[model samples]
Target: MINTILPKPFLFLLLILICAETRAVPVPPAAVAYTADIIIYGGTSAAVTAAVRAAKDGKQVIIVSPDRHLGGLSSGGLGFTDTGNKEVIGGLSREFYHRVYMHYQQQDAWMWQKKEEYGNKGQGTPAMDGKERTMWIFEPHVAEQIMEDFIKENKITVYRKEWLNRKNGVVMKKGRILSIRTMSGKIYTGKMFIDATYEGDLMAAARVSYHIGREASAVYGEEWNGIQTGVFQHGHHFKKEVDPYKIPGNPASGLLADISAEKPGINGSGDNKLQAYCFRMCLTNHPDNRIAFPKPDGYDPLNYELLARVFQSGWNELFDKFDDIPNRKTDTNNHGPFSTDYIGMNYDYPEASYAQRKKMIKAHEDYQKGLYYFMITDPRVPANLQNRLKTWGLSKDEFKDNGNWPHQLYIREARRMVSDYVMTENEVLGKKEVPKPIGMGSYSLDSHNTQRYVTDKGFVQNEGDIGVKAPVPYSIGYGAIVPKKSECKNLLVPVCLSSSHIAYGSARMEPVFMILGESAAAAAVLAIDDQVAVQDVSYEKLEQVLLKENQKLRFGK
Candidate 1:
């Protein structure tokens, strides 16, 4: 009772005492310890390339990967490579394809098909001197062997299954990174660091800014950056008035599926979403080397009813894009409507943590597997179409660990860093110029579907897929890989460089990543030698190193 009647000054004093006690507790020190000339975090093509280049340059390098495997999608069932202009590929990137050729030299390498039957047309790059180099298309295990060989040859230190610390453990002294700790309590201190991950995890943890979703086409003055509702290419669009709801177009009947009933965003404006992601499945029609597609658990027929309708609409060009690899296996990809892409379903994946990412991967696996099972086994499926699809199955020689399911899903694009320079469609189309070239990319600007929405004619149609060719190979700016000097001084991001969604489509290829990786490593080495921030490294010096390394900075005549 006496305390309740206390004066205002006394109460204020007690509050201050409590606040002081709370502030007196000290924060715990970061755990773990490691030291290297360069520490690269990721198992992507860029990560591997960076580690190899650094080691070859006589610098101590360590690759900390959360994956058990070495190569990213290159060894992860995406065997049919997405090579734009092969001439731009040099250094470690070219070395990878050469190894693939070496593997195919053995007669036993053609276990499933004869060597001559497979031919050499799509195997590797056509050399500028009119001779053929190693074929780019390869088996998953073959690519893995090549990566393992690179590691052995370089003797690079690798820490597999180690994830970077995204919390307070990325200790920085001044603007440079002092060290980075992982979730397993392992710390790595390096003079220079490359965040080669597709997600830009390490860069984000170091307080570097990044972007997660697609910006509006107008944001970067891009023509193909945002939602494209009416543009349908390759017959992937819905031809019928399929209801977005579970009750089949009756709004009063309530939502039918897991899709949000909210209004689909404006066609050209920005949205907090991304394009679909799926496994570039390595499949085979060979009987002995194929495992008949397994019916996934919790099989849902309703989930694939749209696909059946798509088939019945005479959109049966199912095998149009099964790009062939060696050994009679195919790096199958999205084709007609209701194909493999799980549209508008992977928005949360880029920024998700490890545990959450695994869950998302599993969910995608179930959905895709169930979709295949439904197509083959469901009574509603046309008998002719079912018979045709029955011949296809997962390749036995690939992804054996998870019942022939690929280990990695293709994350087409994610977490592009907002750096000093953002590459736009204008640059790719040759309508604009970018100085300070570090690397080059020439692929067609490609973006898969971002959403499946109803059209004005009341039919479901695929939207946001774009394929626009560039006038020529364009030089990528070095500033795109480095943040402004005020952001972070010592960090380099190769995989997720600064670019709009439309521009990233061309740059996101694996070969380009390898090119950027080498450039980033070269920049890191130069920075270390000059004892200057990465931003301060002269473009002239960087250009010399890139040229010496055989990296193509400009298109050859």
Candidate 2:
């Protein structure tokens, strides 16, 4: 008989080891303190612009950022700027892209490839122009440097790596944020506050009302607010019929790893599901500045079986949208079915604790990195495709600290505040006019795939990816950014504003976020000056300041 019992001493040692493992915990960061007229949370481009605007108005503004770098997605590998109508981009947002144009004007900026060879392609225009004086697309490092310059020039004080203490950080007084404490034990007191974080951490801590996932169409009286299936406008769906089961056409064999066997809800019904998230990879073919995609710790080829099936079906649009940025680099985004979207991976991210969120982020990183490794090495992929993919590698220059990966995940949409004025599809589509115009949004109503499921006919399919173009550039209301007066009177949320799922899908562009950031700062300054709540700030007075600052509140058709 096999010996199964352990010695008494050995069992005691094992119990002790288990206790030590469970008892070990991360120590809280050392304490620090600050006082400012306005405190902005998050290190996004919006956070920087808001701080600058507040400082320009003579308020003592401070930025408490969780990230070490600035400009969130703009500086983070999403180098291909997504401004649908460049004509509507104005103020600091325009200034940012113009600076990108000037950065390329210098010959030394072209490190990996000659500027002439890189050529004129930026959101369908010359990236490096002297006369028209604007560049919509740029390299990641260039954008980060410019944002840092903005902070230095304005003398804005920023404390990096300081996360808001969600449990008991926000101190409320008379329906307003009196102060907030961070995980680092730093206390900040501000008259007016802005939650510029993508997750709306500060806003949630302040007890503000917010929505986490897609709302049913009936709630908003909109056509495109809920789960979308059998609609493949973006061409990311499967091109051919492929079985979702582990063994082709065999229910006994069960479902594939990526394909969910669960029934996707009624087409227009609601569910607690957020859109997919992926790292916008900055990849290059230059031999000197390329690092091969690494095989992560939990590399499972079985996880990517669906992709192998896709290749078997002869779908070859994988490289068609590896968008070129600068040098010989490309911003590798989700292009085809079973690609980088990582469908059904981020449903809990919006509300997950920091620790849980880290696990989700790591899972996404491993999946994406292993995917590239699989493409280059897996035998199931066609030889021609493997040959083409092997030429590209992660850009060594960008995201140098984090294994050449994008520092920020593309958090397309998250916790949106349900304030007094909720931006619905009608306002976004120009069918209903906003009562108070603070900024403009021009991108399409775009939401990435939320779930991958099996069709009744036994084929793999994706749901919740929609790309409906806006009728025209539409205004974003001021009330959308401000919390309901009854909930919290002094908090402003530019990144996670009051909007329906479909409406936020359009307004969540980086340029629009910067515009709203500036506008939110202007309102904060006004509120502080008048000693009133942010919701009580007059729109007429705020518009005067915005117009003076060259904000394009009204956009042309």
What's each prediction's TM-score?
A: 0.91, 0.94
Q: Per-residue alpha-carbon lDDT of model 1 for 369-443, expressed as tens digits?
A: 887788778877778778977888899878778787887788888788998789989999888888888889988
Give stretches of model 1 more than 4 Å off: 1-32, 119-130, 239-249, 254-260
Question: Model 1 misses residue 441 by how many Å?
Answer: 0.7
TM-score of 2: 0.94
Alpha-carbon RMSD, each predicted model: 6.5, 6.9
| Predicted model with the maximum TM-score | 2
Full-model lDDT for every candidate = 0.81, 0.90
Output the worst ten-in-a-row residue range by lDDT, candidate 1. 123-132
Return the lDDT, model 2, position 314.
92
